[model samples]
Target: MHLVHLTASTLFGGPERQMLGLAEHLPGEYRSSFLTFRENGRCQAFLDEVRQRGFAGEKLRADFPKVRSVLRELTDRLAAMRADVLLTHSYKPNILGRVAARRLGIPVVAVSRGWTWENWKVRQYERLDRLNLRYLDRVVAVSEGQAQKVLAAGVPADRVSVIHNGSRVADFQTPDPGFDTKLHSFFPADTSVSHVVLSAGRLSPEKGFDVLIEAAVHVLRRCPTTGFVHFGEGVERERLEAIIRERGLTGRFVLKGFTTDLDRFLPWSDLVVLPSHTEGLPNVALEASAAGVAVVATAVGGTPEVIADGETGRLVPPGQPEQLADGIAALLADDRTRMAMGRAGRLRMQSRFTFAAQAAAYQKLFASLGSPTVFLQERVTCQQPPSPPSPEDRNAPTRPGRFGSPTSSTT
Candidate 1:
């Protein structure tokens, strides 16, 4: 089976990473190609990581001219590839892919990462996503919450399938060898043993990072040894920096910007915090879990899907810095508790959220639509091979999945 995938932005956001994950981890038997919009996508790093795993990749420099141009380019590519299926991420590609597939006689799968942002255009975006989903052979929501949003937008309940985004277990290097240089270098050096807190992702208001900055004041006053660091850059940089300075936290909070090497940083921190007001499934949390780090996150979106609240990590009400601060403090105060939570989180990830499992799920979804090679009931399994080990797997979970792949499948 041949599949062509399309997306508008290539930033390493939730949906973009999932698209990369599917392309990278799909069983070698089925052919897949990924096309990203624009010359340099933030998502390019993810695709590069895919190729590092030994798969051929293609990138397209496409952009929006008008609504019609999207459909035209989509149909053009679909025909050129003679694609049996066109899988699309985000709203623009979803709509274009659905319409183009209909015109080109191919199946379409529309995958929803989550709401782009809560804004005036949300209704318009939601409406278009609904229309696009209606035309899909299948609609996949990255989390159950995402599925609810799909139904709330007027798509039928039966039309949406909730498939949690998968992470490349091999990409995680738990002992983040460059923990100091690549990531933690931005933080104030702790001459004495200190409390360290780190958060990764874009610098947007929706990330609730400003909330983390607000919470930092109390954390700093209470614990002078505490060092706060953030990795990621975006529109809210100046604003977040200003808030940190005004709060008298100029020396305490460090904004490191985006880095390709997060594995190094996750292992160095006392804790990882995700203050996102909204999310589908977060790759950072999974990465942190794989690195044996505890997360203090807002109990929004698919976060609950990965975190077991008090068991694996702590979840607090969104937008509440006090709650976020308290949770972080509680975890940091007890070394045994923090390590236990991190280990539990790691266990959960290795068992259920590996790239191989997620790829297996996607293979099934594509095959179910009769686009990718279909599996008979007698086949009784999937065709994706096991995920290759990343630099970090030296201390990772040992058990591999049992999904059988064709012997001819490439490693």
Candidate 2:
């Protein structure tokens, strides 16, 4: 099936990364491509890495505010490629993809990734989202919590589907002995870690970074040797920096901004934390788990799905500084517990969070949406999936083998 994936935020946040993962492994002949608003993006590294694995794709620039022109261009391009489905990430693409897909008579799926309504940008996004839902054939949320939030925000619950983002099991591997040391060199010695705590994401208010800073202060009062480093950049960098200075946390905390090579950073730390107020089955937590870094995160959005509290990682309430601090400190003070949790996390991720699994989920959704081709061989298949049973044609059991055969054994 021919498909178009669209998103305005050029930066590859968690959702875009998940999209890249799916795109890379999606089946041949399905004909999936990307539609990026900005020419350059944060996920370029991920996209490039995926391409290295061998997936052909197209990139388009939608930089202007002229919706009419952009819509015309997008519609023309989709028509040219003959895309059967238009899939979008974030609000901007959702706004445009849904509208254009309707005009083009193509199915569109809008994904709600994280906390949908908390930030100031919500109003502007809401303005663009009007009646866009009507055009969307389906609205997929990466987590149940994310789906509920979207429903609360006025989208119909019946129209939404929850599909958790999956991690590439192959991404997990043993670390070289000096790997962390080499990565630590990127930051000042003080920030490197006698006992290191790490968090990654765009530094923003919705991330509740201020709470992380506060938590760090409490963690510091008890363990002076402990230090925290946050990886990523956002609108709140200057504000977070000022808070760091005002709180006299200069030497204790490091703001590393954004980095293209996440593997380099994961090994240098003992624990990973995400104090985000909201999220969609967070990729950072999954990556941290896969890297064998014990996690300490706020219990919000899809975090609970990944973090098994005391088993895989610790979870604290969002915006509660004391609880946040306690969680971080608990893991930092006990290496035995931390390593135990980290190992558990690694195993959990490896077992269930594979890239192939994630790709399968999207493939199923796209199939149900009736996208033209189907190259993604389902985990359960004999040959081809019995023509997908005429959209929930349940009475007809699937016959799958080679991926496109109608009578092949359903694997």
Candidate 3:
């Protein structure tokens, strides 16, 4: 089967890693390729990595607002590749890929990660994405929590599937010999930092980095030698920096920007923290578990499904800096308990969040969509059955509470 993944990638982050990992682990019978929208020139990073991994990747010349041009290009590309199924990532791809796949008579599936709702424009795009979900052949939610949101958007239960993100455990097994030297380079030469607490993700509002900076102030009061370092970069960098200055956390709290080698430093940290207000089974939490480091994260989205409170790590309410600080300080204070939790987290990741298991689930999903030859023959022979009418076609109401009430609890 030739699987084509359609995405509008700006950077090579968690979702990009997930795509590469899936392609690497799939059986030889399945050939995976990538198509990305050129976000000016930002899509090059992901496309470069795709080529380095021996996968076919292309950057579309047309972008959003050029809907007709994009559709024409996508139709030609999919027809040329004879793609079996198309898997879309975020809002732009989901909306456009569905229409393009329909033109080619190929099944298109959308991977529904949770919405960030960062700003006015993004929220509007996500609203359109929600409306677009009901027309796709299938919707794959990254977590059970997100699956509820998919159904709430008017997609039938029969068309939804939950597939958790997998951890690349092997990537974290080997220790970098120069890790200590690299760590010391991030801080001043005169400073003596005893422990490090690391966080990584796009530095956006939904990531809650500002909340993390607030929590660091309280944690430093309790464990003065403990320093906080963050990875990844986005629009919130200036705001987070301002918070660090206001809290007098200069040098103590640092934003290290985005790095592709996060795994090299992940296992060296004393603890991993995820302060996101929303997520779709966060890859940072899974990677931390694979690195044998405990996590302190908000109990939002699929995070609780990854971190077992008081066992693997601590779970606190989102946007609560004091509670988040308490969780970090308490863990930092108890070395034995923290180390034990790390070990348990590593075991949990090995058993539940392996790439092998994730690939198996995707394999099942693809098999249900039918074989490549069968779909091609059906299209060529004009024997394809008519698709059932969508909710929009019947003029059915698909308001927020149409299917069921949204759950109040995060877990």
Rank order by lDDT, top first? 3, 2, 1
Q: Give the best candidate by lDDT.
A: 3
lDDT of 1 by residue, 135-253 (tens): 46677777666666665554544446767766555555436456655444565555332777989987766789999998877776666678888888887899888888899887678
Candidate order by TM-score, decreasing, is 3, 2, 1
Q: Rate the local accuracy (lDDT) of all candidates.
A: 0.71, 0.71, 0.86
lDDT tens readout by residue for model 3, 1-411: 899999999999889999999899899999999999999999999999999999999999998899999999999999999898999999999999988887787888898888988889999999999888877778888777677677767777667777778887888878796885686568775667888999998888999989899999999989988888899998888988888998998888889998888999998999999998998789999999999999999999889888999999999999999999999999999999999999999988888887777788788888787765665566678644345456664445344222222211122
lDDT of model 3 at position 310: 97
Model 2, span 207-286: residue lDDT tens:
88899998888998888888788889878889899999999898778888787667657866889989988887788988
Better structure of 2 and 3 per lDDT: 3
lDDT of 1 at 293: 85
TM-score of each: 0.83, 0.83, 0.91
Top TM-score: which candidate number?
A: 3
What is the total number of backbone clashes in candidate 2? 13
Give the C-alpha miss distance for residue 268 in model 3, angstroms: 0.8
